[model samples]
Target: MPYVNIKVTDESVNAEQKRQLIEGATHLLVTVLNKDPATTHVVIDLVPTDNWGVSGKSVTRLRQQQVKEAIQAQAERRAQEQ
Candidate 1:
């Protein structure tokens, strides 16, 4: 039996997408390694954005900061063009 663990942000995933992820992971094992689909287990761990971090900041905070910087850059570019 083969087991796979997939981790994603909880707020970014839905039921259908989760189902697809499980299916795809299982299929990959079945196709590549010739593992039995029935015996393969795919587990998804949805961690809260606050629990996932990079550069000492949470994923949610990083995303917000990126959007803010993008908007600010766009505004600055427009001002320069005008």
Candidate 2:
């Protein structure tokens, strides 16, 4: 038996996407490793952005920081152009 675990942020995925992911993962194992689809298990775990961390900050925080940086950069470009 082969088990595959896939983790994705819970913010954007929908039911159809999840179904595709499960099917795709199973197909990958069947095609690449010649594993039987009947015996392959694919698990999808969705973690909240606040619960998922990177560089000591939550994913939500990271995204906010990125947005702030992008806005600041855009302002800087406008200032330079003026």
lDDT, candidate 1, 1-82, per-residue tens: 9999998888868889999999999999999999999999999999998899989999999989999999999999999999
Question: Model 2 over residues 9-66: C-alpha lDDT tens digits?
Answer: 8888999999999999999999999999999999999999999998999999999999
TM-score of each prediction: 0.89, 0.88
What are the Cα lDDT values of the candidates?
A: 0.94, 0.95
Instruction: Point out where model 1 deviates above 4 Å.
Output: none
C-alpha RMSD in Å of predicted model 2 compared with the true structure: 1.3
Runs of candidate 2 exceeding 4 Å displacement: none
**Clashes in model 2: which pairs?**
none
How high a TM-score does candidate 1 get? 0.89
State, as a TM-score between 0 and 1, how close model 2 is to the true structure: 0.88
